[model samples]
Target: MSTTTLTPKITMAQAINTALRDAMTADDRVVVFGEDVGPLGGVFRVTDGLTASFGEDRCFDTPLAESGIVGMAIGMAMNGMRPVIEMQFDAFAFPAFEQIVSHVAKMANRTRGKVRLPMVIRVPYAGGVGGVEHHCDSSEAYYAHTPGLLVVTPATNADAYGLLRAAIDSPDPVIFLEPKKQYFSKEEVDVTAPVPPIGRAVVRREGRDATLITYGPSVPVALAAAEQAAAEGRDVGVVDVRSIVPFDDETVCAAVRATGRAVVVAEAPGFASVASEIAARVTERCFHHLEAPVRRVTGFDIPFPAPKLERHQLPGVDRILDAVDDLQWEES
Candidate 1:
């Protein structure tokens, strides 16, 4: 007799919810709170069923004040509590910039390690969700540029579960950027399974012609571009950059060196953005092995546009493919 063990399939949002539930169950110190996170279950419903499962004391709601919410989390962290707070949307987090950069990001160093903030700031980020202004934004570059903060963004459902669990358990503060567009994307996931430690980049596809390095919302676009390139007789690889800060130099450089060509993709603008940093690193580390200058396919340098116009602002498959083609290729 043959038996089939079926693995449950779930969306990224559900996977994240499962992670939160598990974390709260394991540790009494793990508390979750933010705007509408309690009774409303969050805007994307990623925190759904938390209040019922963990109760109001562990998973409650906060006011609309982003700064106050983060400030409270910092105080809670300093007092030995692990607070996982949410910023309802990407641009909505800007109001808490002072609190994040001033206190949350610098508290440990300022205290000479006497106080550690084991906190996770979850920001639902990136475009392609047709959200109005202040609803969608690619703000990873801002947090990644700051020191003393671990910045990570997951592109897959399995990662959505694992990364959040790791972030909650971390001793330092972590900026967890969730790709808003991928929240509903489903896949088979085992929430209890082990995952790679934070800061490791995973190669999604293998190719010899060129490589597409990307993260978050742009990851799917990069993979689709790779598939299209394969149809055109051009083999292309893809690297999913799960962690922004503490970048995986070894893995990223290795993939670029193997292909000898690379294009960095992101929904953020190219000017001095995360995509720019990746392109620079690839160029510097893989210079001798590179056949052409690193290219970037990124969102235009402008404010997050209206919902109807986000398509042009977010990186897409065609733009990524064009960047791949720009990589100088020798005649076959």
Candidate 2:
């Protein structure tokens, strides 16, 4: 469905806020908690004034510990409370790893599918915000490796609302990663609309020559690169794998089969990254359609550096276009 044409005053962040407010109003069982979520209104103000609006009983703040934040949410979920826990930053999620991996991820299966945890862990992720080392990270692979947890990322404001709505409303646990940089970026979204199913990828743009596959934060960059490639008379396909964990292999393989060439893009480090996984699977599934070795233009292998050096490290449209140029396809 397309975004409804309304006054363009709302931003992507506002769309998220709208969804959270709606959810709390719709379901009394839905409780919001996190560090500074009430008085300070969260670091980015995503949860601004929510406590006052919804009352402290449902919307409240927690201690500084992530383990405490998540572990308590697990108990609340088991006891039949839908807790929406927010991680202050992307990298801050590591400390809560034990509770998530040990309890939250295995509870339903450990109970022989009789019990489940209906909790949503919201994390603001990725760089481009000039954050310190442990703040901006595309840690999708970490949670994706853990089974029984639904992992998702939104590239657009509309998907942000739909996916978060579906996530909170679902019966399973969901790890929702939001690109910190895109938090303030404006996008058209109709909050009155219904959302699509979770764990499905959307083909953002169509191309015949090559595919530029990507997801959160980097999707807009891929679209910009595709525009430049089009100006040079090259067809570039851009696919948004909105659902990262339950990756949409059918759509991805279909695009690669048609294009015969693929280049994966992401803000994460180059080594052992999501780009690597996608290239491997695409090569395996679309071997016959291959024209040249699939490539990836991603962040440098080194740690995410200071703001000035980060530009050189992060993959830009020029680099993606360069990957497209470097390929020497035989049949295409």
Candidate 3:
């Protein structure tokens, strides 16, 4: 919650690593458990050094069973422990969905204020890594649609660090999704930086021509396209919707109204995707302000493509610029 700028030298994955380390150090009750998280440091190495620093009890690896991972986490939370469970990939999270829905999500209310579940479930989702169907899946909607689940995603290292910390400390269960493809993407992350609170959107860029709304992996592409749009004499505003469950409609509505056009982007499939909800809600509230229809620039409805053609499959700078080109706007 403090804001002092440190040199930006960490990757998004590294920021997440530091965040988890800080959280564990701050709270003795905080326990990080996942498959291969101990000696293995997780499949993505986000938990690389925890076991050495905090010992095996605080940060340890778990069995391969998803249900067991989730069930054990819930038990630990009920007994006054803060558990952060990491699902290796989006696809592997499905096996634990039942446990999440039946127990972890409802433990607090179901017990009538007698028990609280303070746990964060982190899963790496969305297409673009040329991963298999499950590995690259964007299952935010699935969790968001479930009652009592707080779903939040970060498109940058800063948001990833702060938001994950918030999720870990919250009383309710949180579904924390990371864009695996963005793991290596570098950005200026000051370890001593102040992060915006939960359920907020960050306006990455300002413009008057059109609004590009996205989160997670597509945020960088949208920003790149906004820059390219400037060369074509177009003004584009980019809003990174960091929190998904309790969405930040104010920022998105304001940006779209000012621009009179909007393009919602994501790597998830177009049909019933989270991007669709953003487009639909914006179009509804900003109908009078919109000049052209609010269109979506998202991944194809098919499964994730091979690495060779992933750039074509997922939304990119060119694709975002093309959508911007289609929007109606006044030029000098």
Give the number of the best model, judged by TM-score: 1
Off by over 4 Å in 1: 1-7
- Give per-residue lDDT, candidate 2, residue 83: 92
lDDT score, candidate 2, position 311? 79
> Candidate 2: misplaced stretches above 4 Å?
1-7
lDDT of 1 by residue, 29-141 (tens): 99999999998899899899899988999999987999999999999998889999999998999999999999998999999999989999999998878887688888888
The regions of model 3 sitting more than 4 angstroms off are 1-4, 330-332
Model 3, 203-247: lDDT tens digits are 999988889999988888898898898988888899999989888
Give the Cα-based TM-score of candidate 3 against the true structure.
0.94
Instruction: Give lDDT for model 2.
Output: 0.88
Candidate scoring better on TM-score of 1 and 2? 1
lDDT of 2 by residue, 144-189 (tens): 8799888889999988888989889989999999988888988677
Colliding pairs, model 2: none
When sorted by lDDT, best at the front, the candidate numbers are: 1, 2, 3
